[model samples]
Structure formats: C-alpha cells, structure tokens
Target: MDAAVAAIEESGPSGWSLRELARRAGVSHAAPAHHFGDKTGLLTALAAEGFGLLADALTAAGDGLLDLGVAYVRFAVRHRAYFEVMFRPELYRPDDPELTAARTRADELLGDAVRPLSPEPEAALAAWSIAHGFAGLWLSGALPPEVGTDPEAAARPVLGTLFPYDEDGRPAAEPPRER
Candidate 1:
C-alpha cells in the first residue's frame, strides 16, 4: 500500500500500473493483481484506507468542529496521494463495500461534530464542502501566500466563518453578558 501511494504521488493523476506497484513492493509482478484483482480494486482499497484515516483524525478531534476542520486540511496535505485517489471515484470502484463502510465511518464522525448546532444534512454538506474545497485549493497551491503555508492557521479563520463566535469569542449560542 505504501509503495502504491508513493507511486501515485510520483505518477500524478494517471497513476501507476499494478506491475509497477508490485515492483515497488519487491514482490512478483503478479502479486498485486492476485491480491487486488486489478488497478481499480487496489485504488478502491486505497481510497477506503484514506477515508478510514480521515475518520480517525476527525474522531480524535472530538466534539470541536474547528479542530475537526483543521485536521481535515492537515490530513489532506500530509496524505496527498490518498486524498487525491479518494476523491476521484472514476479511478476506483466507487461502490466497493469496504469503501462504502469507510466513507460512512467518516460521515458519521462529521455528523457527530455538527450535531450540536443542527442535524440538518445541509449543514454537514456545507462543512464538508468548505473543508474539502479548502484542502484541495491548498494542495493545488492555488491559495495565495496570504493564506500562508500552515494548514491549520490558514483554515482557522475560514472555518470560523461556518462556526462563528460572539464578542467573547465563544460560540454565539451562549448567553450574553454585561459589557
């Protein structure tokens, strides 16, 4: 898996062949095919692994939505190959059972993070979109220097927009105090 990820990162969107992955893994040329069936099957497992890792990070962030968003961006930059493969469904088995389970695990975590505010699907989708979009932009180097290189630092203010604070920097849902 590590070798495949390295190959993907080094090869770009066209990705690497199973034989190449086998060679990198120091295995027989048919080893990857025997285990994964084909390139898409291997990519499906890769995508599942990526989503599972993302779920672990977000789960560790706990109930803090801001921290969760920050972790999302950080994970993207740290695991560029996995992130790239995970989103390109056409490159893998989009309906693979393991992939679906992994995606659901991540989705459940995101749902828990946003449940305190509202259980609306729109809220979850909006949060996912912003975090995903921000990470994608950062990975692509499309974000200007003003955004800075620190994923968490750059994402803080952007995520704060979706999860704002009051005068005291507390969530606005809290009761107001005297001036």
Candidate 2:
C-alpha cells in the first residue's frame, strides 16, 4: 500500500501497475495481484481506507464546520493518493460494501458538523463543495503562492468565510446585503 501510494503520488491513480508496486515493495511481481485481485480492487481498498482515515480526522476535529473543513483539506494534502482515488468512482467499485460504509460514515460526519450552522441541506452541500474545491485547487498547485503551503492555516480562513463563528464558537451575524 505504501508503494502504491508513492506511485500514485509520483504519477497518478492509473499510472502504475501491480507489478511495479510489487517491484517497489521488494515482493514478487505477482504479489499485489494475489493480494488485491486487480488494479480496481487495489484502488477500491485505497479509497475505503482513505474515507476511513478522513472520517477519523473529521471526528477528531470536533463538531465545528470550520474545523471539519480544515481537517478535510489536511487529509487531502497529506493523503494525496487516497484523496485522488476516493472521489473518482470510475476507478473503483463504488458499490463495494466496505467502500460504501466508509464513504457514508464520512458523509454523515460532515452533515452532522454542518447541522448546527443551518437546518437547510444546501448549507452542508455548499460547505462540502467549498472545502473539496479548495482542497482540489491546493492539490493541483493551482492556488497562488500567496495562499502559502500550510494547508490547515490556509483552509481555516477560507472555510471561515463560509461558516463564520464568533469567539465563543457560535455562528456570527451575517453582513448587510445590498438592496
């Protein structure tokens, strides 16, 4: 898995093969195939693991939407390989039980975090879109240098813009709107 992650990071999700992973891991060329069945299986496993890890990180970030958004970005930047594969369902079996469960757990956690901020479902979707969009931009190196290299630090302010909170951790007042 380490070799696969490294290969995915260095190249991409489809750039490397099981044989290459085995070679990098110092195992027989057939080892990865024997363990994971095929590239899709391996990617499926990686996606499941990635979602599980993401769920853990978000849980640890507490129930705050801003903190959860930061955790999402942090997980993406740190686990680039997993993040790359997890969202691209074409690369893996999205209906796989393990993968579905993990993905569902992460989704539930995100929804729960956003619940207090707004009762509307759109709020959760918007928050997720903002975080995921920012993470994708950061990972693709499309974000400007002024954004800096610190994923957490950069993410906090941007996420705060969406779900602003006061010092006591309650949602802040919305700014006046133009007529």
If candidate 2 were superposed on the true structure by all CA atoms, what would the RMSD be? Answer: 2.3
What's the lDDT for candidate 1? 0.85
- Write candidate 2's Cα lDDT for 40-120 as tens digits: 999999999999999999999887787889889999999999999999999999999999999999999999988866777
The C-alpha RMSD in Å for every predicted model, in order, reads 3.8, 2.3
Per-model CA lDDT versus the true structure: 0.85, 0.89
Q: Model 1: clashing residue pairs?
A: none
Q: Model 1: per-residue lDDT, tens digit, 99-149? A: 999999999898888777766787789889999999999988899999886
* Off by more than 4 A, model 2: 168-170, 173-179
Q: Which regions of candidate 1 deviate over 4 angstroms? A: 166-171, 174-179
